[model samples]
Target: MPDSAALVKQLMFTFDDLVELDPMSLGVLIRSCDTDMLVYALKGSKAPIRDMFIGQMSERAGAILRDSIETMGPVLARDVEQAKNNILQKAKNLAEAGAIVIQRGDNANSQVIY
Candidate 1:
């Protein structure tokens, strides 16, 4: 794993960050995220955010995700927290590597930056 503190500082996107994104961009980012983190995020999400990810994935993949969510059993709180952190870490790596771009704010003048 990379330096978590460095990662956090470098790319401080949170669930709030995801919420700030337009649906298309959010979907694309979710598509690139790790499976475990994706699942965890979806499970914790409400309808609108959940729909964003589902809309991005292929039908078959979306179906699989729905099934996984339905069938998932008990999970530890720590594990869930870790999974969210892992997703954030991945996002940080992607941003730092310039593999993805994130819009920093709601301003129309704000350009997308990696």
Candidate 2:
């Protein structure tokens, strides 16, 4: 396999010094994204990876993000295709759809919330 794991590791990030992930998560993403390297990177990360890679999409998404950023925005550039562009963004990215099952304060409940 030529150490696909190495490629996967090189593409990961760390949040709070923890590395956590399940196998199918990355595979599903890789399939759905049509082998798009950027999507794969973001989906495969131990942390919620993002556009912080500096136009960090697969060569594919990067090209797209770069064009849009240069043409129409500076602010938009930050999030044009960004996942965890900043710490807050990282937090947001880290939190997945099923990550939370309940809300506190407004409504007390049990949840993973990532």
Candidate 3:
């Protein structure tokens, strides 16, 4: 397995930078990578993760997210944890299940995109 803790931290900074420059919605939008294509990839087999990424931000927003991540480095667990805290701080969810979320297309760090 990879070092998830470090991955989360990197992503947190990436996301923070993206949200700072182009807004969270914009960053998500840029990363969408063609919603239609994502839908096609699903082929009705399973729920597409792209939908989760696109929900809060547009395809353009996705671009920002990608750029931030690329410019920074791989996602770090601490970064992801911070992002998770950001959401948890606002929403209501325990931390135990955070790892499960990673497998569910939340992110490499287990931060729920949706």
Model 3, 1-114: lDDT tens digits are 368975664354432222222234333333433443322322221223333444456467556544444355445455554543444322222213342121222345444332
By TM-score rank, best first, the candidates go 1, 3, 2
Q: lDDT tens digits, residues 29-49, model 1? A: 776777777777667767786
Top candidate (lDDT): 1
Q: After superposing candidate 1 on the true structure, give the runs of residues whose Cα lies further than 4 Å from its correct spot.
A: 1-12, 21-28, 109-114
Q: Could you say which candidate leads in TM-score?
A: 1
Backbone clash count for every predicted candidate, in the order shown? 0, 3, 32
CA deviation > 4 Å runs, candidate 2: 1-52, 73-114
The residue ranges of model 3 lying beyond 4 angstroms of the native Cα positions read 1-51, 74-76, 93-114
The C-alpha lDDT values of all candidates are 0.68, 0.35, 0.37
TM-scores across all candidates? Answer: 0.69, 0.25, 0.31
Selected candidate, larger TM-score, 2 vs 3: 3
Q: Estimate, for each residue in 1-114, the C-alpha lDDT of model 2 and write its tens digit.
A: 669975554244333212122333332332333223333334434333334332233587556644443454233333423432333233334345543121222234432333
